[model samples]
Target: MRTYRYKVQTSSYGLFLGITAEAIQLNAPPTSRNQVSDRVWLDTGRVHHAYSGRKLALNGQEVTWLHLGLREYTESIELGAPGSYVLIIIHALEVVDADYAEAALAPALAKWTEAEFGLAPRSGRINRDSTTGELTFSWDERPQ
Candidate 1:
């Protein structure tokens, strides 16, 4: 098992984390629209979650469609606004899915943004279209 870690810093002040993996088959369907917020609904691998330190472990071969649902707080760093953020670190082992893991994990982060904030915002430096008045929110920001 290779030491693998993925880190993400989000400006969402109060966040709830939930995870899903392809390896574990769900015996029953999710009880609610946002099971991620309901920590009790989450079980390891099946409906994986971390209430305290936010860490998950699973066999590499069993996972393919791993996704995370990050429940967002009311406050958000608007398109061009500045704010503080929280950093989330995910640790995993590389045994059989090293190649696929990289591609699959990248999109999960973006999905988190959509799940937390609506489609109007995206991850990256802030950019706006002057004529259209469109806003491109920043996914990562450096505090000075």
Candidate 2:
């Protein structure tokens, strides 16, 4: 297996972290006034699973968030404004094999990562594994 890493710097103080699946699902439904959004019914069990049964921390500190769950088939995270750097980790297994895994998903993930953290694409670092099928991306403050 291979591993890939990317670094990003966000202007926003807080970071939004979730699986690509959740991001896609969250944006899949059409916007309408009369209908309840699909995001309201999204299942976020995976997000809980990722954080549970392990000591998960960002920048050497435990991650604190206000909300974590699926609403309308989308997993969401709401951490108060705190940090600027965020690391994005993506595994090949997380996506379907037929989808070409990281190769196909990296671009979208990068775009979402930038938007979620309020960072420009040029401000982030992206790394991908050729053989192991792993992708790592991170965002941090840029030098002036």
Number of the top-ranking candidate, with lDDT as the measure = 1
C-alpha positional error of residue 135 in candidate 1 after TM-score superposition, expressed in Å: 30
Which regions of candidate 2 are displaced past 4 Å? 1-80, 83-96, 103-107, 123-144
Worst lDDT window (10 residues) for model 1?
14-23
TM-score of each: 0.24, 0.24
> What is candidate 2's lDDT per residue for 12-94, written digit by digit as tens?
22122333332222333333311212223222223222334332222211111111111111212223222211122222123
Please report, in order, the local distance difference test score of every candidate based on alpha carbons. Answer: 0.32, 0.30
Error of 2 at 139 (Å): 9.8
List model 1 lDDT by residue over 45-130, tens digit each: 32223334434464442222232323232124122222322222233322232222333343344454444334444434333456
lDDT of 1: 0.32
Number of clashing residue pairs in every model? 2, 26
